[model samples]
Target chain A: MTAALETFDLCKTFGALKVVDRVSLRLPQGARHALIGPNGAGKTTLVQLLSGVLRADSGRILLAGADITTSSQQRRVKQGLVRTFQVTNLFRGLSVLENVFLAVSERQGASRQMFAAAGRRRDLIERAEAIIEQLGLAGDRHRRISEIAYGQQRLVEIAVALSLDPKVLLLDEPAAGIPSRETSLLLDAVERLPPDIAILMIEHDMHVVRRFAREVSVLVGGRILMTGLPHEVMSSQEVHSVYLGQAGQKRFTAGVPHV
Target chain B: MTARSELLERHSYNPIEALYWLLLIGTFFAFPNYLSIATTVVIMALFALSLDLVLGFAGIVTLGHAAYFGIGAYTAALLASGGWREPIIDAVLAGLASAGLALMIGPALLLLDGLPLIMVTMAVSAILFEAANKASWLTGGDDGLRDFSFLPVFGLFPWSVYGQTSYLYALGWLALLFVLVRRVVSSPFGVALQGIRENRARMRLIGSPVIGHLVRAYTLSAFMAGIAGAVHAQTNKFVSLEVLGIDTSVDVVVMLVLGGIGRLYGALIGAPIYILVKHFAAEWNPYHWMFIIGALLIVAVRFGYGGLLGILGRIEAWFARARGTRKP
Candidate 1:
C-alpha cells in the first residue's frame, strides 16, 4: 500500500563513465512503471543495482522502507524483489513446466528434500501449472524450452520470474524479439498479473509501453529527463527532441509522429 | 497399449542404462571367479560415479577429486587401526571427514571456473599428496597402511574372511551410494544444478544462489568420493599417498568422460570399460597403455558428444530409421 521500491541518489561508475548518474525514483505498490531509454542509457545496469546483481557506487535501495542495498541476489529475491533478463534465461534442456516447478519448489522451501521424487511435490506442480496457465503457456508446458518458439521462450522466462512469488517485478525488455501478435500475449500476461505486484519494465516498443504503463521514466545519457503519466511524457518537447533528434521540427505522438 | 503405440513412447532407456545393467549383470556373473579384479572395478566405478556428480551434473571440473578419495581412505584406515572398528561409524565419519576437506577446499576451488578450476584442484591434490607422504608417522609414509579388519556390514557372518567379505562389502556399499546419489541428482537440487550449468546468471535471478549450490554439490560429490575411498581402503586393506594423487583424480575424470558426462550411469559404464582396457593393456604392454588411453580419450572428446553411449545412440537411430521406426 506504499512505495514498494525506492532508489535515492543512485550512482554507478565503470571506469570514468557514470552509468547510473544520481538516479532517484519511487515505485509505489501496484504501479506499472515503464523505464524507457536508448541503448546503453544504463537501464540494465540500474536494474542490476536494484536487484543486488551489481552494487551501486553510491545509492540506497529500500524495499517497503527497509534498506537492501547490500543484500545478496538470493536474499533480495526471497524478500519478494525479482528481476528478469533482457535475453531469455531458462533451463534450455528442461521442460517448460519443470523450469517453473523448480522456482515454485524453491518458493515452497521443498526443493531440498533429498529422497522424495521432485515430481511428487504436488503443491509445487499445481502452483506451477496454474501460473503457466495464467501466462498462456500451459499448451507448451510439457515441451523442452529449446523446442519452444522464441516468443514462447520469452514468455517462459517471465513465467519463471512469476513463479518466484515476487512483490516487485523488474522486467528487462520483456517484449524484445517478440512479434507484434506475440507481444500482446506478453502484455496480456503482464496485465493479468495481480494488482498487488508492482511492475517496472524496460521497453523499446513505445506502443506496447503506452498500452500498458501508467507512468513512464525516460532516461537519456544515463540521466532521467522526465517522469510522468504516459500521455504527459509523450507530449513533452524535451522528450520529443531527445527522441527524434533536431531534424524533425514536428513532434510525434510516441512512434506515430516520428514515422 | 498397442505394440506400435507402446514402441512410439519417448521414454526409452538411455543406452547408458542398458550398459549399466549389462555391466552389473556381467560383473555379477563373471566376478566371483576373479574377485580381486572385479572388486577393484567396483571400487573404481564408485569413484567415477562420485566424479560424475560434479563433472556431469554440476559442471564443476576438477582434476583433484582424488584428494577427498584419499582422505576418506586414510581416515578409514586410521580409525580401523586405532581400535574403532565399527564399519558404519568409520564410513560415516570418513565420509564426513572427506567431505569436510572438500568443504574447506571447495570454496576456494569454486572461486575458479573452466581451466582455472582444473589447475587449482590439481594443485590442491598435489598439496594433500605431499602432506600425506611427509606425514609418515600417521600415514606409514610410502610403505602404505595395511593389516586392518573392516567391520561387518549389518553383522553379516559370511563377511569374516578378508577376500570374500570385502568384495561383498564393497558391492553393497557401491549399490547403496549409487542409489543415494541417483536420488539426489533427480531431486530438485539436481535440477537446479543443471540449470546452473545451463545458465548460472539466469538461475541466480530466479533465486538460486549459484555459488552456494556449487559448493553444496561439490561437498556432496566429495562425500560420495570419500565413501568410495573408504570402501577402497577396506577392501584392499591398504591406504597410501597415491590415493590422494593427481593420477587418481585424472582417472576419475577419464572414467566420467569415457562413460559420457551428465548421465548418472555413465560412470558405471565408463569405469568398468576403463578398468577392462587398463587390465588388458597392462598384460599387453604396460609401457604403452597410457598412450592408448590418451588416444581413446581424444577420440571420445572429439567424436562422441555423449561418449560411447552417443555412438550407440546414433547407430540405434540409424537402425530405427532403416526399419521405418520412430526416433526414441
Candidate 2:
C-alpha cells in the first residue's frame, strides 16, 4: 500500500547550519511510528517542513500519492495532513469550544458565513461539543484556554488537530512538559484516536514510545541514523553509543530486552 | 448545562448593552443646543466603529484608515457636486467605492503584520493625501470641496444652520450602520478573524484562508469608514483635504483605543468622548485642550488596560461579587 505521508530527499538549511539534511521518512496508513532524537535533532523543523511552515530547500512531499511540495499550508490541511506544536499554542483569549469550533467550522465550510452567528449553527455546535466531550473536557467546554490545566492544554492541542479529520497527524512532544500523573490522560487521548489515521509522534519517553509506536527512527544531527522495529532500534549499538550512551541509555533499556 | 442553555445564556441580549443604545438615543433630545457637536460625535463614533473592525477585532494595527474615510468623502463630494442630489444613494455609492479599493489593495497590504503593517497604513493615507492635493480640479484641492447642497434628507427635511436635519440625518445613518456592524462581528466570519489574529499559522493549518478573510474584513472596514466620510461631507457641506489627512487617521485610533479595542461598544464609547472633549476644551482653552486628552489617555492606559469598557466590565464584576450572585 502507498504511504499515507511521504518525504524523499528532504533538506533544509538556515544560513551556514544544516537543519534537515536529505532525510527521508514515511508513514503508511494506520501505521503508528515514533521519531526518537536528542535535542536539536531537527524533529520540529521536519514537522514544519511537512506542514509547509518552513519551505524545504530541495525536497518533495507527497500526501496520499500526490506531490504537495509547493502547496500552501491551508491546502495541505485541506488534503488531510495536520500538526500540533511542541508547546501549547491555542487561542488563549477565546473559549475552548470556540477554538475547536474554528477547526470544525473550517472543515465544514461554515467559517466563511458572514451572516449567521456561529453559536446559532446547531450542527457546528454539536460537532464541537462532541469533540470536547470525547476529550473528557465536557465540563471545561465554556472555560478559556488560560483557565485550563497544562495537561489539559496539551490535550487541547491534539484535540484541535483531531477536529480537522486529518489522515496523517504529526504531534511534536505532546507530553513534554506534563507531569507523570498528567501523562496518562494525554496517553489515553492519543490511544482513543481513530485507528485508520497514521500517527508519527516525536517523543523523549521510551515507555510512551514503546507503548504507542510499532516502528521507530533514531535521528541525530539532522540525519536518520536508523529506522526499524522498536525492539531492533533499542538493541542497536549505534543508537546506544551516540549520547544515550551512559545513564540515559540504561534508564530506557535496563530491562527492555524481551524473551 | 444543556447546549441549548449554554448558547442561550451567552447570546441573550444584555440590559447594559440596551442601556448604551438608550443613552445614545437620549442625546438627541437631552441637549438640543449642542446638536452640531452631537452630529460630529455621531459621525466620529461611526468612523471609530469602522476602525474597530480592523484594529480591534482583527488586530490589523492600522495607522491610515483615513484613506477609506477620505475616499468615501471625495466620492460623495464629486458625485453630489456633479448633480447627484440624493444623499442616501450617494452615501451608499461612496461606501462601495471605498470597499472596492480595499478589496483590490488589501490582499498585498494585509500580508504584513505588526510594525510594518502600521507604517504601511500611515504611508497609504499619506499617498491619498498627496493624491487629493494634486487632483485639485476634482477634489477642490486643499481649499476643500463645496458649492453643493444635498436634497432634503430623502427629499423630506431641509438641512440648515440649526443642525437639526444634519444631526438627525447623521444619527439615522449611525443607527442603521451600527446594526450592520453588530451583525457582522457576531458572525462566523468574525470568529475566524479572531482566530487569525491570535494564531495566524494555526488558522491556516485549520484550513482558514488567512489573507483572504483579512481582506474581506478590511473591505468591510473601508465601507464603514467610507460611509462616515460620506456623511461628514453631506452634513458639513464640505470635504476638506484634512478628511484624508494623517491626523484624522491617528485620531480615530485614539478614539478606539480610549473607548476599548475589541468589543463593538468600545468604539461607541471612545469616539464620543474624544470628539466632545476636544470640541468643548478647544472652545474653552485652545492651547491647553490637548493636555486633557493626553491626561485621559494616561488614565485609561494605567487604570483600565482595555480602556473605558474594561473599567466598566470590572465594575460590573465587582458589583456581581458584592451582590453575592455568583452567576454561572
Candidate 3:
C-alpha cells in the first residue's frame, strides 16, 4: 500500500547550510512515528518543508500517493496534511473554544459562512466541545489562550490540529516545555486520536518517544542517520557518537534511560 | 446540561445590545439642537466601523482607507451631478465603486503585512488624493463638487434646512449597516478572519485561505466606508479632495482606537466621542483640540488596552465577581 506521507530526495538550503539535505522519509497509513535529533538537526526544517511552510530546493512530497511538492499550505491541509508548531502557535486573544471552533468550522467547510453566528452553529460547537473534552481541556474552553498555562496551551495546540481531522498530523515537539505530569495528559490525548490518522511527532523526551512512537527516525547533520524501533534507534552507537556526545552516550546507554 | 447552558449563553441578551438601542433612541431627545453633529457622528461611526472590519478583525494594518471613502464620495457626487439622484441607489453605487477598487487593489496590497502593508496603503491613498486634486476637470479640483441636488428620501421627506431628514437618513443607513456588520462579525467567516488576525500561519495550516479572507473583508469594509462617504456627499451635496485626505484616514483610525479596536461597537462609541470632541474643541481652539484628543488617546492606550469597550468589559467582570458570579 502507498504510504500516507512520503518525501523523496527533499533538500533545503539556507545559503551554505543544508538545513534538510536530500532527506527521504515515509510514513504508512496509521503509522506512529517519531523524529528525534540533537539541536540543529533540521527536524523542524523538515517538518516545515512537509507542511508547505518552506519551499524545498529539490524534492517531491507525496500525500496519499499524489505529488504535492508545490501546493500552498492551505492546499496541503486540504489534502489531509496538517501540522503544529514547536512553539505553541495559537490565537492568543481568542478563547480556547474559539480557537478549536475555527479549526472544526474549517473542517466542516462552514468557515466561509458570512451570515450565521459561529457560536450558534450547533454542529460546530458540538464538534468543538467533543474535541475539547477529548483533549481533557473542557474546563479551560472559555479561557483565553494567554490565560492558560503553557502545558495546557500545548494541549490546546494539539486539540486545534486534531479538529482538522488530519490524515497525516505533524506535531513539532508537542510536549517540549510541558511538565512530566502534564506530559502524560498530552500523551493520553495523542493516544486517543483516531488510529487511522498517521502521526509523526518530533519529541526530545525518550520516554515519550518510546511510549508513543513505534518507530523512530534518528536525524543528524540534516539527514536521517537511522530508522528502527525506538529502543534500537536509541541504543544505536551512531546516534550516540553523533547526537549525544561521549558523556551523553554513556548516560543514555547505561541500560536505564532517564526520561 | 452543558450543551443547553452553552446555547443559553450564546443566545442570552448582552447588556451592550440594550445599550445600543438606548443610544439609538436617546439621540433624538438628547441632541435636539445639534442634530447635524449627531448625523455627522453617525456617518463617522459607520466609517470607523468599516475600518474596524479590516484593521480590528482581520489585522490588515492600513494607513490609507480613505482611498475607498473618497472614491465612493466622488462616485456619488458625479452620479448625482449627472442627474442620477436616487439616494439609496446612489449610496449603493458608491459602495460598489469602493468595493470594486478594493477588489482591484486588495489582492496585491494584502500580500504585504505590518509596516509594508501600511506604507503601500498610504501610497495608494496618496496617489488617489493627488489624482483627485490634479484632475480639476473631472473632480472639480480644489473648488469641490457642487450643484448636485439629492432627491428627497423616497420623494416624501425633503432635505430640510434644520437637518431633520438628513439626520434620520444617515441614522437609517447607520442602523442598516450596523445590523449587517453585527451579523458578519458573528459569522464563521468573521471568526476565521479573527483567527487569521491572531495567528495567520496557523490559520493557513488549518486550511483557511488567509489572503482571500482578508481581501473579502477589505472589500466589504470598503463597501461600508463607501456608503459613509456617499452619505457625506449626499447630505452636503458636495465632494472634495479632503474626502481622500490622509487626515480622514488617520481620524478614523483614531476613532477606532479610542473606542476599541476589535469590538464592533468600538467604532460606534469612538466615532461620536472623537467627532464631538473635535467639533467642540475645534470651535474653542482649532489648533489645540488635538492635544486633548492626544491626551485622551494616550490615557486610553496606557490604561485601557482594549479601548472604551475593553474598559467596560473589565468593569463588568469586576461587578460579576462582586456579585459572586463567574466571569464569562
TM-score for all models, in order of appearance: 0.89, 0.93, 0.92
**TM-score: which is higher, 1 or 2?**
2
TM-score of 1: 0.89
User: Number of clashes in model 2?
Assistant: 0
lDDT of 3 by residue, B217-255 (tens): 999999999999999998888788999999999999999
Model 1 Cα lDDT, one tens digit per residue, A157-211: 8888889988899988998988889998889888999998999998878888888
TM-score of the second chain for every model:
0.89, 0.94, 0.93
Task: Report the error of model 1 at residue A13, Å.
Answer: 4.7
- Against the reference, the lDDT scores of all candidates come to 0.82, 0.87, 0.88
CAPRI-wise, candidate 2 is medium
DockQ of each: 0.41, 0.50, 0.50
**Against the true chain A, what TM-score does chain A of candidate 2 give?**
0.94
lDDT of 2 by residue, A177-201 (tens): 8897888888888888899999999
Candidate with best TM-score: 2
